[model samples]
Target: MSRSAGRSARSEDSAPSDPDARSNGPRIGSDISSNFPDGGQASAGGASLDRAGAKDAPAATIASDSRSNPRNSDPRDILLDALRAALDAVGGYRSVHRRLMQEASIEGPCAAFAVGKASAFMMAGALDALGDRIEKGLVITRHGYAAEVIEPGWPVEVVESSHPLPDASSIEAGRALIDFLRRLPPRTTLLAMISGGASALVERLAAGFGAEDLARVNRYLLGSGYPIGTINRVRKRISLIKAGRLANFIASQEVLNLLISDVPGDDPKVIGSGLLIPHTAADIDTGEIDLPPWLTTMARSAPDLPPAKTMDSIRSEIIARPADARAAAAACLRKAGFDIIEHPEILQGDAVEAGSRIGRMIALAAPATVHLWVGETTVRLPPHPGRGGRCQSLALAAAREIAGKTGAYLLAAGTDGSDGPGEVAGALVDAGSIDRGQSAAPGSCPDRSLRAADAGTWLEACGDLVRTGPTGTNVMDLIIALRARSPASTERSFHAG
Candidate 1:
């Protein structure tokens, strides 16, 4: 694979020099109306919450026209508000601080290790709540996501690595994690802040496995279109640190896991491939998933790891989840006078198919209703795929379904502010998105892009891509749709223009 393949466009160089500057974070609620091809509609902004002050801050302010012309408001603005609300509910700084403060027994010298996309934010929170009690700290995060929240003279070490795929630095991080655990004195309280993307950010392979083998297996599973649960199950089988095996090295008296769930059921075992959580009987079974011959052989031949020691000193809690984000989003829309129709079931299965189904549903549904769906979607990549993630693919597919229809708009995005391998969070599609894309690249077909898994390229041409940088949280994916009120009822109903 090429160096640029599956890498985020936003490099660390693009990040602001002063980590303390609020502008260094995502541009939440920024006016980006000109980015869209369709004039008047604003592109969705990112989560605006200030990590340094989130503990005492209210929810990030969402830009809205509810007091002025609610009817003429942009669906993108409404979607942006919902996104902001979702982030507020699951914001790492607030959630981690609140959880730590509630634990009365958690005192004395502590060691902290925060890993994954939300590492910086979560680490900052831990530092705040524990203060001088935290004697040592480690932060393993995705590249370009390093935030300097650690105070001077602190013993905290930060390492940036790869994500959605593992690289050499991932291996280094894995070894460092084990060393960090081994060096801690017995009886020290260990605070483990685990979140989404931990699986790829750090790993200690089994004895027989090499970095190449790990990368190849991960690439295959990612392109296989399997759900995250299945992928994580396979991961646990191959890692020395995953599937609670990391517990083997802990010298601490108490292990506290504070997580921000990105999986379907919010299973800690599945989140980050269960770095400290054990696998159940169900987790051991791969179910009906048919593994490729190479993977099957590897699994059969892999050395068995010693069972993780069960300890009563360990405690785990899910501080934030997809449901929390969805509920918060629903509340924001409801406050804006739109009727809500939230899907009770999690959205799963193929991304393209889900988008088509949702697009048709929203186009035929009653007006003045905001339809909301939350869940992660999968994409089966071709031999060689193009630039895009599941959210972009879903958005483009939806654009095909709603072509020529008026007053219909949809937004599909990952809560992490990254969709697949790109820097942009996701995409927002209107009824005319297909035509706009085709016009931008004459003779281009949306179907071809979908088939090639190149929806990001086409979405960019259409001016439909939504970029939010790092969102400081990860729950799962969110989908929001709006159908305008009928002309006859326009005077009485609140609708996005």
Candidate 2:
């Protein structure tokens, strides 16, 4: 990938660097090893966060007690370092880089198509690896991502699409895709490279809910603060194809799908709405639920089929997942000598309830210095406008109870390097973050008394955002890293096991 597109620096253009009350940390130099300790699973790198009155290290920043060399044993620093490693671990570029066609390479890929924010570079790398075999490539991606592939003969079907929301372009892409599938040879081998935003890239408006209806419904959901799963559930009902019907086309041909999972849990049925795989046979009865007036009206008056059909012949391999990022991060932390407790990667439930549970768990379980969780959950939005993503919303909910306890760090970042429609993947919720937010934004910061929507705005105000410019791969998210007052330090605390 081009260095120009690399996560050069955090965008403080949205927010300026704070001047006062910042740590006196010295800037760390470059030359940090981009390689990971693992032989070769994921790509790796390092980064630092924003702080006032402190020198920013493009490599890694630590609040320097000694001005010369700054490598504090602070848990926050370790967690942040681990976070950087985790992001690096799941990169999609190295995958492309590794697949280059060397002199000894005998053959190239039969077919390939890479899409989404990271599609250009990744796809280019794939083509470079496969060389001439990368004929008839289908790249239905956003505008900027199309730059990665410039091969003259390779058919690069470019399409401008939206993310975190679907639009008319998505419908057009969907139609084009259907046409392409229909025109492809019956025996032609296909390599469909799918990633996040594909659903919006090439999408068909679900039965009754056209782009206008979808736009309106999305607007209402954001305003209402509904969970993503509920929205998807309702969505599954209206589309003719989603829920796996797209894969149904090449039922007789072979499709080796290389998917970059962007949805929570990395569910194929969720990523790009399962263009090549069906999680289950689409059943309309399961999607029925109390919906908005417009949606309810549409649901009552629409066809039951999704826009596409399910194909059984497309085989897939998930090259990236939440586990890859989580495990890599844990390895980095252990290298830094932190006692960590590994958590499951399948957490689910209502957003507020999940937040409360995580808070209580952190406050009570005083055993490990860090806790890690790597699964996706549903937010179930309501009927009001708010200002944050799932991670922010969760952070605010957890902060209501975990505030000011000291030493607790919570990172909720999506594997896709994006969270909702915003640039931020997630946020870090420390003991100081809550009170700090209250102080930073006063009544503006969301407290336990929030109306759900306020939490979004609070995250934006306090500079708690953790943004990873398109990391390439999608694999749910990780709620990893735990920092709190150590139980070993407290002699007779009730929280100590």
lDDT value for model 2: 0.56
Candidate 1 residue lDDT tens string, 1-497 = 11132012113343322222322111233222212111122112222222222222213432332322434355566667677677767867657866776777777888999998888778766765666677799999998775434334456789888887798788889999999999988889899999899988999876666778887987898688887668877877667788777888887778998889988878787888778876665565554669887777666554454355554567888998888988989998888777999887899989999999989988887777888888988887898999899999998988888898787888888877788776878888888899889899999998999899999999999888876556567888989888866655655445334
Model 1, global lDDT: 0.73
Best by TM-score: 1
| Residue range with the least summed lDDT across 10 consecutive positions in model 2 | 28-37
Regions of model 1 farther than 4 Å from truth: 1-72, 148-154, 207-209, 216-231, 280-282, 285-309, 486-497
Q: State, as a TM-score between 0 and 1, how close model 2 is to the true structure.
A: 0.68
Tens digits of per-residue lDDT, candidate 2, 1-497, equal 22222222212442223211122222221111221112221122222222221112212222222212243345544555676666555555434434232223224335566656556545644543454565566666665444323333345566667665677776777777777777776767676677666766666654545678667766776666556566666565555456665654553356666666655556777776665665543433434456767677655453433233334456676666667778878897776545777775476665567776787777665644667877666565557755566666676677766777776667776655566655567776766667777778666646433455456567656556665544455556777647544545422332334
